[model samples]
Target: MRFLPSVQFIEQSRVADEFVAPAAVLANRLLDAKGLGGLPPCSVSYFIEELHRPGAAIGLHSKGRANVRLNLAWLAKLAQQETAPEWEVAFVILHEYAHFVLELLEAREVSPGATRRRIEAGHADFLRRMSHLGWLADPVSRKLLSNHNAIAEEWYCDAFAYWVAGTLPEPHAEFFYELLAGVRFPPTS
Candidate 1:
């Protein structure tokens, strides 16, 4: 995968470090170990500044391809603190990569009209299932039912992170684990 140009900001008192390298390696290791090899090549770029988006999202992935942009400000904070868990950075990278993989899967679909609707409905169905599994109050899952494409993409990414890390403290994490229980290894085309 080709990495695009990235911008970094570090206080003059602190030394800049290669955080991206280790994060990428960890993300790749999880993807390979999980047998999710169908995803196309992708790149991740890091920045110490806030993204131009309106909310406080820590990362962003391109919708149609395997590319990610991470918030280095958050990463650097985690790097400097001893209390920060090792899986934090890796989870962020893996989640973004999952978004790429899902989008690649969607784009590769060659079926006609109803197929697209069916795929979206499948994702929505999963979200609805989560509600029944005790995730009814989760904001993300609630959005999932109405915001098909983007919310489903986020759900898939979060599920990938949960799968890699083995646990998530979030209220809706159980929903992801339940989904994982039924998925076939290496994933079908």
Candidate 2:
């Protein structure tokens, strides 16, 4: 389903309109790409909040609920960076949307919740794939990979976002392409 702004989001538009509107536009593009590839229909609700952390955005979806929270402070900080590219904000938004897509696919499964083994296996597969790209050895990437529970989803989102952003490296990009292409949601009428 197309991303739908939450009622609260619309009510608070005056406070976040400048950023939220643009992010929504980019989100639509990312969602369209996923839809064309067969991801499930799921509505996204977003809000600007004091995430109070460095993360610019976070996406959550499960059992039919999906939402994205954007950290205004972090986003402003990133925008101030001299090296920040024009597409940085859009990429951040798209990354979060990727999380929603993956979670929706998991939720739509016949048996619903994935087993711990399944999740761990997915994490292991991610590590192996990153290792091939020579990213696993990087200290920062290594630390993130070490916490499979906390950071595994980020890895998936990053792969999907980077792939769509046209920045994911070689075979890794192909990995996300096939991974997403495998989602088999019933066609929405």
Candidate 3:
């Protein structure tokens, strides 16, 4: 598959080329299907292990560097599974791409401060409701909601993934629903 000019796949993992190649192709297809085939140049690197974080993270986006890091170990495992692992992997890629897009939007001031503020407010309100419902009691949820901006950014990213993919993978549906309850995408213009 021909990848978008904006995205380059960087292989820095011990996983077999057979596994990495398919994942990269799937990622490209996912982005292209979502109409995100014209983004600015950025690298998507596959790493040998999960990123150092509080929870089980399969992917991460580095805003300062404008790049994405995926866990090759995780992808390899998924590739071996008989079920539809591609869907989950697609979600992860799109989630990170959402972060990249968010950073670009903010850096270019595409919608100025209004978009960020709306996302923050929407996510803050979602958190408040979740807190009242005791959903924040879970350690993973707590860690994910460490701060206002962090949670807001996460909400937007997850929402973008869902929006682009049409559905969250079954395993992540509940968690994503909780994070994105009432958070609508801000107007692009």
Candidate 4:
């Protein structure tokens, strides 16, 4: 049940080659641990390139296309560092992979729309409860939590990453736990 996507390095680099295989292995192991070994092999492609995003690094999962793009420069840089950001890199890859998995799970549903509505409602309720606890009083926090679908998707991805790694890197670790404490994603049937 090991799933290895077609990995392509847009730019020729020893660093990219060195990391892709191990990253894929980590991803597969995580998936297997999560009982997702039942998923049929998919034609997902992993493209390593400079994402051109204005952040330290980023990864993207093209919706419905099964294409995951990881920041090549970032991977290379992380590898060259004294303290390799193994957890960070894993998080990026797993988060994007979660998006692909979530889409696949939704596609398997008899009623995808109903599934989405349930997710949105559940997430909205969570936000409301958190707000009542004065946890989301900050304007920035409120604005970010305003979009149920977006926040839910991000939270699900984060949860998947946490589930895979069994932990999350700092700054995110505490928030992620609090955000997903009682949420059941895709809402179990």
TM-score of each: 0.57, 0.59, 0.55, 0.59
**Over the stretch 1-189, how does candidate 4's per-residue lDDT look in tens digits?**
121222323355454655665666676566565555444332323344444542233344444444455666555555555664656666666777766666665666677565456556655664665567575344334433545326777766655676556553333335444433333233212
Name the candidate, 2 or 3, with the larger TM-score value.
Answer: 2
Clashing pairs in 2: 1-41, 1-42
Cα error of candidate 2 at position 65, Å: 5.9
lDDT for 60 in candidate 3 is: 45
lDDT of 3 at 163: 58
Local distance difference test, each candidate: 0.52, 0.55, 0.54, 0.53
Per-residue lDDT, model 3, residue 70, is 60
Clash pairs (backbone) in predicted model 3 = none
Candidate no. 1 TM-score: 0.57
Better of 1 and 2 by TM-score: 2
Candidate 3 structure quality by residue, lDDT tens digits, 69-184: 66655655564466745556656666677676766556655457855786687667656755775853544334335553366777767656665554533333454443333332
Tens digits of per-residue lDDT for model 2 on 1-189?
122244333454453445456656665565565443354333434445544465556667666555666665555454445563336666666777777776665755666565333445565775776667585454434543555335666666665666665666555556665556556333334
Which parts of model 4 have CA positions greater than 4 angstroms off? Answer: 1-11, 41-51, 54-65, 129-150, 168-189
Candidate 3 Cα deviation (angstroms), residue 94: 1.1
lDDT of 3 at 131: 71
